[model samples]
Target: MTLLKLTGIVKTFPGVRALDGVDLEVEPGEVHCLLGQNGAGKSTLIKVLSGAHQPDEGTIEWAGSTVQFSKPTSALRAGLATIYQELDLVDDLTVAENVFLGHEPRQFGFSSRGITRRRTRELLARLGHAEIPAGREVGRLPAAGKQIVSMARALSHDARLIIMDEPSAVLAHDEVENLFRVIRDLTAAGVAVIYISHRLAEIREIGDRVTILKDGRTVAVNLPARTTPTDEVVRLMTGRSVEYVFPPRSAAAPEGTPLLRVSGLARAHEFSDVSFDVRAGEIVGLAGLVGAGRSEILETVYGARKAAAGTIEVDGKPLRRGSVKAAVAAGMGLAPEERKSQALLLGEPVYRNVSLASLHRFARLGFVQRGRERDAVGAVTRSLDLRPADPRRTMRTLSGGNQQKAVVARWLVGGSSEGGSLRLLLLDEPTRGVDIGARAELYALIRSLADQGVGVLLVSSEVPEVLGLADRVLVVREGRIVREAPASDLTEAQVLDLVMAGERAATAR
Candidate 1:
């Protein structure tokens, strides 16, 4: 029997028809993969299924019976659960508390803490993460740990079907393998999974069937996940074949004095003795697993974190340590990995967020010029092909890819200043939750920036991203750069070996 079915689903917001006549079917004990480009209605359809949004027109059948879930709690009560990309765990609460928050076991009208802790531990063990402490606060745990807690919470409810949105975006390779193992166990126990991700390779490995959505409608359904050709899949989602996504590297090698230089950079426990230089018109990439100090290095260089001992120089001039103002004054801009939290203003207008870095340019004495700010923001955003193309729209209304574009746009706006142009651009995980199509666009954009003589430094968990997009590849292992070579000289397998076992190999050599 079909575990869940949807026919002719339609959902609309004020000016957008998010979902239009979408259809889906899922069976028991199978991983149903959802594939689409960003803004292709995948999010809206999931919202409808999870009861966050009501479908304007559709028939949803749960276990062969028509049902309506007016709210998230209603859906959860009916054995449906959703684990979003942005985790919704409370920071101050313990793991046990977050797992059983709303539906705690009670004895004599009091919640049973003992039972909750025991259950949480059991769930953690089942998910192959026995090291995660049930008593530890959720916020203190790493991203992978928080993901496990969310899954434990879903399992606690005895959910028959679960939806995971980009669950592996934050996980390392070993963690992703552990997740697949847990999914196998769930499917063995007859739990259906609706897996959403932009990684086609993952779908081939874990999914049983596939569904493709385009422009708020289903383009293809019931395709074998393991056998679908890459070109066919890309065409269905993007209306064009994009096999060679990465832009070509520049023929002229970077030479002359370095644009940005770091020597003996160290942060107590995160990283140490990191020394590197990026020359004008160069793209340098740092590749490693999560928590490998790649992001910490970028933050330290950009003055977001204080360096215990080191010197940073832009154009041969020393930068003030631990001062964001000095870094900005030196024409350095960092698009952090966690853009929503560390970079963007979600509640403000798109124009405001774009102009945040260069607000002083639009200010005169005691007053400000709003028109010039909007116009400048508009020009940059339009050049980036920002969707909707409206500066007045709220930043939160745009898709993940669009939000990333806005973050990059802010730096471009600052570059227009008279004496302070962007010298070096630092990007950490530039395509974290973005779709494949958007990833291609960003790759081209980064290359274009470098072509314009702007030095670029990038950090990515994806080895291929570093190898394909960067001119130089720096392999980081255990908070140190274990290997440095031209990107053309490194292979994916070699980079992985360097990241996982580079220190041992280096010692032996």
Candidate 2:
């Protein structure tokens, strides 16, 4: 019997029909993989199943009985749980308290901390993470540990079906492998898992059956996960037979004095003696595993972090260390890795967000000019092919790909406006959380900026992205630059070998 099923699910929000006549089924002991591009109704369907939203039309069947989940608590009581990409755990709460937050084990109508901690310990052990102390605060744990705690909370509710959305987006390679192992064990115990992810290789590895969603409908259901060709899956999800292809490299090498130069840059334990030069019209990439201090280096160079040693110069002029204002004034811009938390104002409109750095250009007589602001922002957004093309749209309503475009567009506006020309652009995981179709656009956009004589400094965890898009690559390991080579001189395997060499050396010692 199917553990859970949804038939003809229809959901609509203001001006958008997020899901239309979608169907899905999950069987006990199976990992049901859900694949789709951004804005393709995957999130809406998950919300409907988890009782975050009531479907406008459709029937939900759980355990062979038709049911309606009016709220989140109702779905949890019925053995369904959702783990969002941004986990909802309170950072200040202890692991035990988080696991049994609303439905704590009680003795005589009073909460029992002892029983809660013991039960939480058992769940962590079952997930193969017995080392996580129940008394420890959730914020103190690492990314993988926090994820395990999320699963433990679901287990505390006796959840028979758990929906995980982009669980590995923040995890490193080893941590991702561990997560898969836990998923396998959960499936072995007959718990159903609805796994949603953008990585096709991961779906092939961990999923038993694949369901493809496109434009709010399930186009293919129950395809064998391992046997299906990636091209076929891409076709179904994007309505195209190809994934985002990287743009061709520039034929001419960049010339002239460096647009941005860093010498002997050091930021305490994060990174040391990092030196690089980005010439006008050059794209240079930093290639490393996550937590290799790539982001920290970018932040330091951009003056977000004070350098313990060394100097940063833009256009041959030194910048004030640890001052973001100075970096902006010096024609430096950064699209950080975490756009939502570090860069964007989700509550504002797209135009306002795009014009954030160039606000002075739109100001006159101690008042801001809204029309001028929107026009300038609109031009940049159009050039970037921002969808819906409506600057008035709330920033939060757009897809991940469009949001990233806006972040890049902000700098484009500031670069050309009377503020200052953008000489050096720092992109941290520019395509993170973006779909394949959107990635191609961003790749082309980055190259286009380079062709316009803007020096680009890129940091990406994906080795191939660095190799394909960068004119030169810097391989970082253990808080230092271990190797530097032309993009043509390095292959993915060679890069990985260099990256892992640090780990091997440490282990040997």
Candidate 3:
């Protein structure tokens, strides 16, 4: 039986018609993967279905009955729950507390500790997680650990349909495999799943059927995963031929001087004795699992995070750690992994966030000259193709893809070639959560930056992304650089092997 049916769904946000007469359906005991590009109304559809926002026009028939979900609790009461990309589990709470948070199993009109623990443990076991103690604080648990707890919480709600958005984005390769196993178990128990993710590989792995969304409408639905070509899904979501999106690799000068070099880089309990060099006009990628020190290594070089022992050399000049000002003085720009937290100022205006990193360049003596700043930000915004080119618009209002472009814009502005202002760019998970077309744009932007002789060290968890975009890829695990290979010939299996080989205790992928 069809677990959920959505018809003629429509939602509008200010100037954006987020969803325009959308349609979707999910069957019981099936994984229905939703595919779409950024700003294509995917989130809006999910929000409407989950009752975060009411649809302007639509109808939802859930479990054979038409119902209106005015709030999330109402949806949950109707046996539907959603897990967002940013898991809603409270970090300060215990696993059991989070699992049965709102409606804890109660006896005598009070909390039943024994029953909650037993129930939490049972849910964890059913989800293939027996290692996590129910009483342990969720703040202390790993990301994957917290995810399992979140899943258990959904089950605790007695939800018949579970919607997971980008469930595998933060999970390591092995953890992803674990998640797939759990998803199988859920479907086996007749739970209908709505899976939304950008990782096409994971969709192919576990999705039984797919629904493709383009712009604000469902373009196709109920396509069997095996029979449908992956490229067809790509085309449907992007509206760009796969050839145009990926394109041919751009040529770069491969024989330039080493722009940035590291020797014996060490960050206590994070990364140890890591070393690599990125040549001028080159894109060097760091590929590893989420906790394998990829971001730490980049942070160490950027002076955002402290390093116990290491040496960084830019343009062949040895440098010491500490002080982000010093790192910037030495010609380094770091775009951190958590773009929202570290880079973009959501509350501030677009021009402000774009010019934030190099505000001094637009300063005159003791005051900021807004004209000079506006000019700089404007140029970068136009060059990067940031929508509207409105310097006065708030960063928070822009879509995810445009927000990322603004972050990249920060690094592009200010810094003469002769000065030590913009020589090296360190981008951590540059394309994380961004769509395929945006990713292609970012890759092209990096290639353009490299062509301008800026060395780039891109840190990403998706090994395939590294292989597709980088000139050289470095694999790190357990704070150590285990292998370095050309991205062209490096395979995902080889990268996983290096990550697992370096981590003896890690589970197999």
**lDDT at residue 251 of model 2 (Cα atoms):** 92
- Model 2 residue 128 CA deviation in Å: 0.9
Q: What is candidate 1's CA lDDT for residue 288?
A: 90
The backbone clash count of each candidate, in order, is 0, 0, 0
Which segments of model 3 are wrong by more than 4 Å? 243-253, 364-372, 415-420, 489-497, 501-509
Could you tell me which 10 consecutive residues in candidate 2 have the lowest summed lDDT?
500-509
Candidate 2 clashing pairs? none
Q: How many backbone clashes does candidate 3 have?
A: 0
lDDT of 2 by residue, 403-451 (tens): 9999999998867344778878899999888888888889999999999
lDDT of 1 by residue, 318-337 (tens): 99999888888888888999
lDDT (C-alpha, whole model) for all candidates: 0.91, 0.90, 0.84
Off by over 4 Å in 1: 416-419, 502-504, 507-509
Model 1 C-alpha lDDT versus the unseen true structure: 0.91
TM-scores vs. true structure, each candidate: 0.97, 0.96, 0.92
